[model samples]
Target: MWNKIEMKRWHRLFYDQLVRRWKQNIVFAAATIFFLQFLIVKLHPSEVQEFNEAQCADIYPKLKQGLISVNEGMRTLVGHELKLIGEKEFDVTGYTVKRPLLNCLDQEDELLHRTIKEKYFVKGNVSGRGFSKPYEELKHPYQTQDLLELVFKELRNGFYVEAGAWDSEQMSVSLLFEVGFNWTGILIEANPWDHQLGLLRNRNALYLNTCLGLTVRPQFSDFVFTPAVEVKEGQWMASMGGLSETLLNPDSIKLQCFPFYSILMAAGNPTVNLLILDIEGAEFAVLKTIPWNKVDIQVMTIETDLIGKAGISGGSQEEAREFIISKGYTLFKHRNNINPVTGLENNDLFIRNDIVKKWNIKFPEPLN
Candidate 1:
């Protein structure tokens, strides 16, 4: 009996040790998996691209191939060449070339180069044109020239505002400063990560980490942020309607109240010479909410897409036009013309009439 009892006690001890080891192993495995996932997310292309790939899978084959080709061409040519010019201090006097190599590279490159140059260079934003997104094969023409001209034409040195600034490596505000737009504006962003990045990129620009709604002051509400920070009720949320509840996981979202009007008022109420709005689908709501008549805004450029999955539409663009027109602003230029049948072109511009009359800017013949 004593021997049997001792044997049972030994077995119990063994079982406990085995359970402890199993639990430790399971914990270690879980930690390892979490670490790997973190590394992948941090090192991967971008959250936007990932989301695009996952959600836009069906359109990926058509859009992705073209986007990649354009991206490679642009990456090889534009930003790199500009950087080289800066490093070497080389003069870009009449350095224009419609290279066939751009077409021969790939369908993506061909589409990208054509769209980027036409939209960005012809309209004037940057000095050169290139693909804004390479991997996705989406050709985004940087209007370096238009941007430079605007910077030089309007602001020698003063406040500038960039509304709807979001988190995308391609839409860096630093590029504005690099091309010499005196960083004087309120950088408004809704997403936490993008807002944080904007703050990092533009040190001189005052960063407002909230969405601009129709309200005169920032109001405390809940916002739907992805992966990093879920819904918290304490953060300030924009008052725009028609937001996707599923994407935001509305249940877990949090809201925070903030003073929107106070921040703008504090930003010196400087005459806004140039305004760029690319706030996804919320552009119309935000614009409608603002007292544009009271503000001395000079030139406004916006992105208009016929079938934006994010709910941007022609109606929104028209509404924006009407709003600007009501404020005695005229349409200066329209760029990145897209065929509703084919979702190809990325960046487009719409300038105010007052800017056109003042600058004597000529519009490029509409591309068929």
Candidate 2:
């Protein structure tokens, strides 16, 4: 029995050595073949194609034909149905169009403040309660007028927080300044290139070049930029993803951990009236971590889409609506109806219940 055990041990050692040697030989053979192919390609470029033709020509045509037939069949089955749907398409001319106006009984100043108060907390056609102004009309004569309108209707002057403030070109910043909202807000952005632009545009706003997370634990974070295709001149607003999912060289991307509460405290712990979250899919993580009771944020606007490349999933439109209701907010308006396929409304708005109740406003039950 001892002799048999010793033989078994010897056999194991011999097999291990054989595997090691085989692996080395295989690697050596592969490297040699690669070097030879490289040399051949360098010396006779035309011969590379000739060799491929000789090796794969017999099966290449059949494979190509099979793939083409499958693609054609799929196109006929699915594409034809989509074409027949005939969704009406329209173009978004610009941000400003015919909007609703507030029908309140008071003097201009009183009406302005009343309008601001109603829209500030409630969600509905708050835009129409005031005036029609384009995003570019930041410095217009009716700028203050429009600002007062939003302030009275949708924004809480001293108690609001905005995340992912990309640049000063955004409508939110314009209204914030124009209305003279007593804002103590922190603008968090990860991109250095865009951060500089944001500084120039939002000179008055506090800027931080870091991503927000659930904890303040010291750790690395990754940010990846994906360019926007349909929109012109706003590539910086493209959806952000983690480096592992986006970057070709994951090692090069650096990450930093930050606590969500730290950001809120940094913003001076103002009564958070409005929380505009446009952190791409990062919204899911940030929202999940928020101390909702401490931060009485009344209104929140978030972007929802099915084609998100960020690893987030499972929040359908219905789910999002229910989630907002659970948090005491209601869907108000769907904005910018430039549907690419049918060109109708796309953007959405949600308002807190307190605002709706205070203003005595009512909206139909949201379509499931």
Q: Which residue segments of model 1 deviate by more than 4 Å? A: 1-144, 149-155, 167-169, 178-181, 220-252, 255-262, 306-315, 337-350, 365-368
TM-score quality measure for candidate 1 = 0.48
Q: Write the per-residue lDDT of candidate 2 for residues 1-368, one digit (tens) a residue.
A: 01111322354565467567767799865764564354333322221111133433443354344432211211100000001011332221101000011111111223323323332211212123221234345332222232235434444434445565544333343344424544445555654434444454433345565555533222234454442212223322223333222322321233333445555554445665556655554555556566667666655655443223243433444455566677777676432322242122233456677876775545434332
Q: Once model 1 is optimally superposed onto the true structure by TM-score, how far is the C-alpha of residue 66 displaced, in angstroms?
A: 59
TM-score of every candidate: 0.48, 0.49
User: Model 1 — which ten-residue stretch has the worst lDDT?
Assistant: 75-84
Report, for every candidate in turn, its global Cα lDDT versus the true structure.
Answer: 0.40, 0.40
Per-residue lDDT value at 126 in model 1 = 28
Native-to-model Cα distance after best TM-score fit, residue 87 in candidate 2, in Å: 39
Q: Residue by residue across 205-320, what tens digits does model 1's lDDT show?
A: 55554444433322223343321111123422121222232334321222221223333444544676667665544455455555554466666655443212333222444555
Candidate 1 global CA lDDT score? 0.40
